[model samples]
Target: MAYGIETRCIHGEDGITREHAYGSMGTPIYQTATFAHPGVGQSTGFDYTRESNPTRSELERIVSSLEKAYDTVACASGMAALSILLELFENGSHFVCSEDLYGGSVRIFSTIGANRGLTFSYVNTADAELVEKAIKKETKALYIETPSNPTMQVTDLRAMKALAEKYGLLLIVDNTFLSPYFQNPIDLGADLVVHSGTKYLGGHNDALAGFLCSASKDLADKIRYIYKTTGGCLSPFESFLLIRGIKTLSVRMERQQENALKIANWLKEQEEIKGVYYVGLPEHPGYEINKSQARGFGGMISFHTDTAETAKRILERVKVISYAESLGGVESLITYPMLQTHGDVPAEIRERLGITDNFLRMSVGIENGDDLIEDLAQALKGE
Candidate 1:
């Protein structure tokens, strides 16, 4: 029987029926550098922790199930996944990427990737024509982040897939914002889906993990080969933590998005707030496109305050919502993109994207909507 995403969250696609020595409620962490050989000219399935581990394999299986991908690789972090992914393309290959992406992605592509001979064109992917215009003979892929980081710009994935098909280019999507419970890019024709499993998949400010899920055997094999060679596979213990965290994925995402929608609505009515960027809001430019593709708008919201001082002061004043970096945990977090996530980007580009000093991005937790609203209310009033 096909399982719903909620069921897939707790029990995975196979339920708890996988054969294990001890029938433990949770998947056990292998926590060993190497696995013992069964006998001469024989092996135990796994030979080395870096190549594969039972715990990490289980983590990959569950994430693959969530993404509806042929397979997935558990990585040390999101950047590691991107780094390994870059290996699939030859040197001097160009990629058409979304402009409003995670600052770290911009940093990696421009610095390390450029240093290694990979070139990138950053465009507003919300406009399919703009993305197409950026493409050329050297372009190998279209890399985009839907409901992009901080600014929440939503790109039409199907349109991008069509562009990829026309150009014979790979379509790579970062599905970190709306976790697999809410969106599966593979189903929409993306060749690969990327996740910073540390955020929603791990669902706590605890473990750090990332994943690359491939839709086809060829892509999966390529990712696996690079993954094993680079040795950036997630540790056994972190894999176990991520598996534990994913078991609660459905509940966490629902509650967080619910809180996010409420918060977005409240932010719009506040005189101290100038703009609110959330895909859930009907007034948002990409609202309909997002609703057509994703099951939910997710927990991230970006709003601009009346002044930069108000933005900074609210970060200091909020009691219920903490001011910090990283997101998709149980605790609500408000971040200053100018200083935090998007700090490395050029000032002119930051201004063009409207990610200014007065802008604030929020990761709504599963906190009570009333409590979160009251906290925002007081923080805005300087009470």
Candidate 2:
């Protein structure tokens, strides 16, 4: 049988044992911003904090081992990691991306990136034919998000990988939601995998960090160059905290997954719920592909209520679930796409994508299942 998630949580990357250390259970935080050289014109170890540090190296090794990648580089934020990845391609290169990516990513691509000679086309990547037709000779990368935001549409990674190989295109996947604990994109043939460690990997939403991992040495080198030169690397102190958070990732994720499934089922049966979107639900369109790639359905679910008015009232009344945008925290959060996460998305595209006023997204937490269900029920009650 596979190793249980709890075991992985506790000992996933604790390489050094008590015999090697001073019997301290926790990894020490190296908070210094600079390191000294042994002699003039000679570097003994880490020379500067920006290039590398002991704490950050430990975190990188742990994340790479967990993700089953050859290399991993941590950054100040998820956006910084993405920006570094994009530097690999030259200006005027075309990119094919999914229509429903994270709102911040979409904003960067559409607004800030447009002036850099980068052009893009957003298509429903679920349809292999559509993706095939969108590729141009200038296309350099195909960026995608599985279990896409708001709509929860899952993309076929294996199929996309095949297409990328055939077309000489780079495949980049955002594995933030499911995390390396639940899924490893490198195993599925992706060229590069990105994560907002601020989410599940950090587990408590206490750190702002990002990571990019790859199985290829060349790709890893390219990413490392951007990471060091662009100067957006994560701090040593934050890396230490992230390593601490990751020790409990598997257990926390297991609880969150259980909670999400329970809430999804309960919401599906409610009369006020117009539609529920979760890969675990048998009726979901992405079920088969998601099941093949992921060990389990992740802890994110979105649903549409009877109307926008009802959604507004429920959001205003929910007691346990906070109305927040970021996810993967111990406490649950609810967000409205059109007004929150996807607020920057154009009105026309939002309507076409069914990110209507009635839609609500729930980032389920490791809370008592019954209590969470009751909160939703009462929030939906007509007063």
Candidate 3:
């Protein structure tokens, strides 16, 4: 029988079995740096950990299956995955990118990639016309983050695909916000899908990991070559943690989204709140498009308060929700994108994008919805 995504999450591309490793039920961590060869002419496939490790390979295979990709590369961090993917483009290549993305991504493109002869144009990718206008003859790729970081702006993937095809540009999507359980960019014609497995994929915020998935074998192979050479591969222990974390993705996401929707709705009713940026909200501009493309609206929500003072008070007062920088964990996290996630973004650009001092991003967890709301309520009310 063809398995559902939830089942696939548990079983992975290849189902778990004892036969694969001397009757071991779980995937074992091949912690060694090098696998011993059977003999001079024979091998055990894994010659070196950098080239490949059994534990990491299993995690990659699982992500590949989840994303419906021909192959996947596990990296040490999300930036590492993106760095490997960027290697596909040569020097002097330009890219059209989403204006509102993880601050780290903007930093890489503006600083690191710029030093390497790469250039990028940032636009509101949700507006296809703007993206089209930004494209130049040197543009080789479209890098976008749907339900973009603090704003929750959703881009039309099919529209982007059409543009990419017309321009013969690679379409790279940052699927970290939704995770594979909620959205598969590959199914929507993304040339590549990048993820910060450190967030939702790890689900616990304990392990840092990243992944790159691609349907094209050629693209995958190129990325794999860069990944190996760069030596940013995830360690065997981290791979094991990620594999374990992915098994509960379906359940965790379901509960997290459930709580998020409740919190988002509650936030909308609050007198102090100015706006709630969550795709699940009917009033959100991206509601319909996000509904059509994703299985869930995701647990990320960003809202604005009446003033920066009020926002800071809430951030400091929240007792149940931790004030942290990362998201997609089981524990609720509230981030100030202005000073945290989007700090690297230029001040003018951030103001234009509405990532202001009053803005706050929340990664709702599996906590009881009522309790989470109560926490926010007390925080907002300064109780």
Q: Which 10 consecutive positions of candidate 3 have the poorest summed lDDT? A: 12-21
Give the distance in Å from residue 130's predicted Cα in candidate 2 to where it truly belongs.
0.6
For model 1, how does the per-residue alpha-carbon lDDT over 1-383 read when each residue is reduced to its tens digit?
99998887777778853556577777877889998999998998999999999999888888889899999999999999988888888988999999999999999899989988999999999999999999999999999999899799999999999999999999999999999999999999999998898899999999888899999999989888988888999999999899889989999999999999988998899999999999999999999999999999999999999899999889999999999999999999999999999999999999999999899999999989999999999988998
- Residue 55 accuracy (lDDT) in model 3: 93
- Compared with the true structure, what per-residue lDDT tens digits does model 3 show for residues 1-383? 67788987888755854336687768798888988899998988888999899999989988998999999999999999878877788899999999998999999888889988999999999999999999999999999899899899999999999999999999999999999899999999998999999999999999999999988989988887898899999999999999999999999999999999999999999999999999998899999999899988989999999999999999999988999999999999999999998899999999999999999999999988999999999999997
Worst 10 residues of 1 by lDDT: 16-25
**lDDT tens digits by residue: candidate 2, 291-321:** 9999878899999999998899879988998
2 or 3, greater by TM-score: 3
Candidate 2 lDDT score relative to the true structure: 0.86
lDDT agreement with native, every candidate: 0.92, 0.86, 0.92
Task: Judge candidate 1 at residue 158 and give its lDDT.
Answer: 96
**Which regions of candidate 3 fall more than 4 Å away from where they truly are?**
none
On lDDT, who's better, 1 or 2?
Answer: 1
Residue 12 of model 1, lDDT score: 78
Worst 10 residues of 2 by lDDT: 11-20
Q: What local lDDT score does residue 17 receive in model 1, on the 0 to 100 scale?
A: 36
Measured against the true structure, the TM-scores of the candidates, in listed sequence, are 0.98, 0.96, 0.98
